[model samples]
Target chain A: MNPLRWLVGRFPTLALARRNLSRATLRSALAITAVVIGVVAIGAIGTGGEAFKQDQLEAYEGFGGTATVEPDVQFEDGNLTNTELSDGDIDRIRQAAGSATVLPVHEPAGSFVQTQSGTLLFRARVKGLENPGEFYEARNGTMPDNWRRTIVIGARIADQNDLEPGDRLRVNVTDEFDRSFEIAAVLKPQGFSAPLGADRTVFVPASEFESGGYEQAIVRVDTTTGSVDAATQAIEREFNAREQLVRVEQVQEQREQFTEFFGTVNQFLIGVGAISLLVAAVTIANTMLMAAIERESEIGVLRAYGYPKRAVVSLLVAESTILGVVGAAIGAPLALGIGMAINQLLLGDPFAFTAAGLRYVGIGVGFGVVTALVAGLYPAWKAANKRPVEALD
Target chain B: MAPEPNEDDGRWQEAGDHATSETIPTDAIIRGTDVVKEYETGGQIVRALKGVDFGIAPADFVAVVGPSGSGKSTLLNLLGLLDVATSGDVRLRGRDVSTFTDRERTRKRKETIGFVFQSFYLIPTLTALENVEMPRMLDRTPTKTRQRARQLLERVGLGDRLDHYPDELSGGQKQRVAIARSLINDPDIVLADEPTGNLDRDTGDRILELFDELRRDENVAVVTVTHDDYVAEAADRVVTLIDGRIRETESRRANFEEGPDP
Candidate 1:
C-alpha cells in the first residue's frame, strides 16, 4: 500500500499502542519524564540566553553613543594601577574625528560622600564630566550651572543618602581630602551600563578634578558624516599616533562580542542537553526491546490474526512517538515557566517571548519526537521480524 | 480410505445425505497434499511432518489426534497458513497458497481462516468486545464490524462480559472470547490448536459443544488439534498421526453419540 493509505490504515494500531502504553503506566511515565528533562533543558536555556542577550543590547543602547575612547590601563596582577590617557590625547581625538562630539570625563577613584546627619556613608564612584546634561536628566533638581563644589547623585544614591536639592553633603575623596558640596540635582535611574555607572554614580563638575586630567572621552559620531566604524577607526588612528597604549572601545562591538560569547555558551548548554536526550533515547530503546520481548506471544497472536509486519512496526513506532509528543507537550510549557522563573528571580525582568525562543520550543519538540522514532526503529524491526510459529511457541 | 486424492483439484463432493446433488461443490475450504515440515535445532534436523495429506469440507468437524511429537500442531499451522510447509502445497479454496507473498498470505489469512490457541491469547489490555473485533479491525472494515463482534460475543454466551478485559474474565470466559474472536470475520475455516488444553474437563466439554454448534450453524470447516479422546470422539471424522505421518482415518456415522471407549 501507499504510505498515505498505510498511515490511514493504522488507526487500530495507534489505538492499541495507546492501550498498551497505558497498561504499563509507570514504565511509560519514566520514559516520558526523561524526554521532558531533555526538552526542558534545551528550551529553558535557549529562551533564557536569548532574553539575557536582548537585555544586554538594550543596556548598551541606553548608554548613548556607540564609540568611546578610554586609556589603556597598566595592570599588575589583574589590578588596575594607572591610566595613560591625557588631555592632549582627547584633543587629538577630537581633531581627527572632526564631526564627532567629544565629552571629556574625569573619574576619581575610591571616593564617597556622607549625609549631613552622618547617619550613612556610601563608597561611591565619582564621575566628573564637562557636559553631564548630555548623559543624565534631572529627577528632583536642576543640573549645576557653575563649576564649583557642587554635585549630582544618581537616583538610587540620592534616595539612599536622603539628600535632595540644596542639601549639603560631605564628600571624602580618596580617604584623605574632605570637602562639603551642595547637592545640586538627582539624576533619573539608568540600569547597568559598562561604560557609565548610572544608578549608583555621583556626578560632579570636571573642574573639581584636582588630581589629574581627563580619564576617558565619550565620542558620539554624527551618523550623517560617516559610519560609527569609520569614526572609531579615525579616533583609533589619532590615538595610535599619539601613544602606543590606547584602547578604543565601541558599544556596538561590545554588544556583538557579548552576543557571540553567549551564543557559544548557549550551544554548549544545548549540547549538554542533547546528551540527556541521548540517554533518553537509549532508555526508550531498552524499554521497547523489553516490551517487545514480553509481548512476543501477543505479537504472535496478532500475526496469526493477519496483522502484517508493517502494521506491527507501525504500532510500536506510534507508541514511542506518542510518548515523545506527550512529553514535549508537558515540557514546552515547563520550559517557559522555568524561563519566567529565572527572569523573575535571577535576571529581575519579565519573561521575554521572542520568536526565536518560540522556534526553539518547536525545535525541542521536534527533536524529542524524531529521537523517539529513530530509537524505536530497531525494536519495531525486531518485533516485526518474529516468525509467528516461533513466537507462539 | 480412498487413495489420498492426487491433485486436490477442487472437484471433491461430499458423499453423505447432506450432499444436495451428485455434482461437486466448490466449498473445499482446506486441502493439504504431501505437506512436509522440518525444523533444525542444535545441528539436528527434526522432521515435524513427513508427508501428510489432509482436507476438510464445509460443515465438517475434523479432529486431529496424535502423540506429543506426532506433528499435529505442525499440520494445523500449515493448514492455517500460519506456517509454510518445507515442501508440498496447502491450498485454500483450490488456490495453492505456498507460492503466495507475505502480503497476499496475510490478506488470505484474514479473510479465509481464523485461529484459536490453547492459551486463549486474548490481548490483556483490550475488552472482550475489542478482542473479538481485532480481526475485523485488522481487515480495515470500517463500520458494522463492531456490531458483528458484539453479536459473535453474544453468540458465544459472552454478552454480559463484553466490557471485561481478559484478566477480569474466567478461563472459560476468556476461551469463549477467543472463540468469538475467531468467528468475528466469518472465516471459511476455524483452526483450533488444542483449544481446550488449559480448560477443566467440564469446561472442555462445553467448549466442544460450542464448536459443534458453530460447525452445524455456520457451515464452517473446524479443524482441531487435540490429544483428548473425548474431543476425537465428538468429531465427524478422526485422523490419527504417529511420528509425523497419518496412521489411520476413522469416519463416525453419528457425532458424539458414542464417546471414547473407557
Candidate 2:
C-alpha cells in the first residue's frame, strides 16, 4: 500500500483525535491560550526591541539631517586650559569651507544672573556680533544686533523669572561687571545636554567677551550639502592645509555615541525575547505531554489497526505544530501592533512601519516553530512506543 | 465408526457427513500439537495451556467448549494469531506460526484468519458498516471496501443498521457487526472466542445460526470457543477441553442424537 494513501485514509482517525481534544473545550482552550500568551510575549519583545534599536540608529545617523561642528577642546580651572582657536584661524576656516557654517562664538568664563525676584546663576555663551541674529534668534524674541545692552536666557530661566522678550532684568556678570540689560528673548529649551549645566545657559554677543580670542567655533550646515561625511572631510582638509591652531568636532559624533548606547539596550531586549521563547517551548512541551497521557488508549487503538510507529509520532507532532501555528498567527500581528504602539509612546508620535527591520518577525515565527518542534519530540516518542495491549488494558 | 477414508488431513469436509474430497486442499486451517502456555504472576507460574493438540480443517465448524480458565480462550488466541504458544507448533496452512514475529503474525491474522472477540470489540467511533470495513482497510483488496462491508452487514441481517454505531446496536446486532468485520478480509479461517458470550440465549442462538449459515455457504473453517452447550451444538463438530487439554471430539451426528454429555 502507498504510505501516503494510508495516511490519507487515516484522516478520520486524526479527526477523531481532534474531536477528542474538543471534548473538554474549556481545558483545551485554556491550554492553547497559555501557549498563545507565550507566543505573543516572545514576538512582541523581539520585534519591539528591534524597532527601538532601528529608531535609535536612525536618530543617531541623523536621518539625512545637518552636519554639526563644535569645539574639540576641554576647559578646566578658569584658565585657557584647552587649545584656543584664534579669530584669524576661525576666519580662515570660514573662508576655506563655505559649505560648513562657522559661527565664531565665545562663552563668558561663567557667572550668576539675579533678577529682583530670584537669583539665577548661569554660564554665558556668546554668538558672534557679525551675524548673531542669523543663528541665535529665539522662538519668543529676536536677537539684538548690539547684544552688549541686551541678552537672551534659556526658556526655563525666563519662565521661572516671569520675564518676556521686552522685560528688563539686572544681569550681574560680576560685582564690577554688573549691568542692567533688556531681555531681548528667551530661546526654547533644546532638550537634555551632555556637558551639564546647559539649562542655565545665557546667550550674549561674542564682541562683549573680554578674552583676547574666541574659545571655539559653532558651525551649522544647510543639510543640503553634498554629504555630511564629504563636508566633514572637506573642512578637515582645509584646516589641515592651513595648519590652523584649532580643532573641529562634528556634532554627528555625539549622535553616534547616543546610538551606540541604545544599541546595547536593544541587544539586552533581544536577549530577553529569546529567553521568553525558550520558556514558551517548555510550556508547549508540558501541555502536549499531558494531552498524550490523556489519549494514550486512543493511540493504542490506532496501533492495533496497523498504524506504524512513525504514524503515531507524526500525528502527535502534527497536533503540536497546529497549535503553534495558531498561536503564531494570532501573535505575529499582535506583536507588530503592540511594538508600534510602544514606539509611538516613546517617540511622542507614531513611526512609519519600516520593512527593513523585518528580521524580528522572522525571528518570532522561527522561534515558535522550532520551539514547538522541540517540545513535540518526547511526547511523540512516548506515543509511538506505547504498547497496544498495555494501552488498551 | 464406519471405515473412514484416509482423507487429506487438512481438506474441507462436507456437513452431516465427513465427505472428504481429492480435488480440494486444506493443509490444516489450524493445527496445534502439544501447545503449552504459561504466565508468571507474583512469582507463581500459572499454566494457561497444558499439552493440548487440536486439528481443524477448511469448512469444518469446530467449537471448543470448556469452563472458565480451561484454556479455551487461550487456544482461540493462539489460533487467531493474537497470542503465541509457549511450546509446540501451531501450523496454519503448513507454516508453523510459533516463530513468526509480531508483525508477521499481524499480517497473517489480517489476511488468513478472522477474529470475533467475546466482547464484540467493535471500533466505538465507527458506525456498524464502517466497523465492518475496518479489516478491509488493512487489506490491499481491490474491491470497494465500503460496498463489500455493506453487503456483509446485509448478509448478517443488519442491512438497516449500517449507519448505527456500536453503542446504538443491540448486543446481538453488535456481534453481527463483528462477524461482518471478521469476514471482510475473506480469510480462510475464523476464530471466534466466545462470540455470543455477552448476548442473551435467544440472541446468541440467532448469531450462532448466522455463523453456521456463513460456514456452510462460504466454506470457511470456524473455530469457536464457547462454554455454552447450545452454542457448541450449532457447530458441525465439538471438542471438549478440560484442564487445558482437549478431552474428546464428538461428531455432529452423534451430538444431534445424544445431545451434550458432560
Task: Give me the candidate number with maximum TM-score.
Answer: 1
Clashing pairs in 1: none
Model 1 lDDT per residue over A299-339, tens place: 98888888999989998998888888888889899988887
**Residues A1-393 of candidate 2: C-alpha lDDT, one tens digit per residue:** 577545535564454445445555665565556556666676666556656655555543432334433445655687544455677767776766666666665544545566656555443332333455655447688767655668776666676667788776665543225666677878755433322122355665554566656655666566765455665666677765565434555656766676677668766766776677677677768777887887776665455545557667876777666566666777677777787786685454445455533566666776677677678789989977876555654
Q: What i-RMS does each candidate reach, in Å? A: 2.3, 4.4
Instruction: In model 2, state the lDDT of residue A263.
Output: 65
Best by lDDT: 1
Off by over 4 Å in 1: A1-10, A70-83, A92-193, A196-216, A220-247, A343-351, B1-27, B254-262
DockQ for candidate 1, C-alpha atoms: 0.44
List of chain B TM-scores, one per candidate: 0.85, 0.83
TM-score of each: 0.78, 0.67
Cα deviation in Å at residue A20, candidate 2? 4.5
Q: Looking at candidate 1, what is the lDDT of residue A8? A: 38
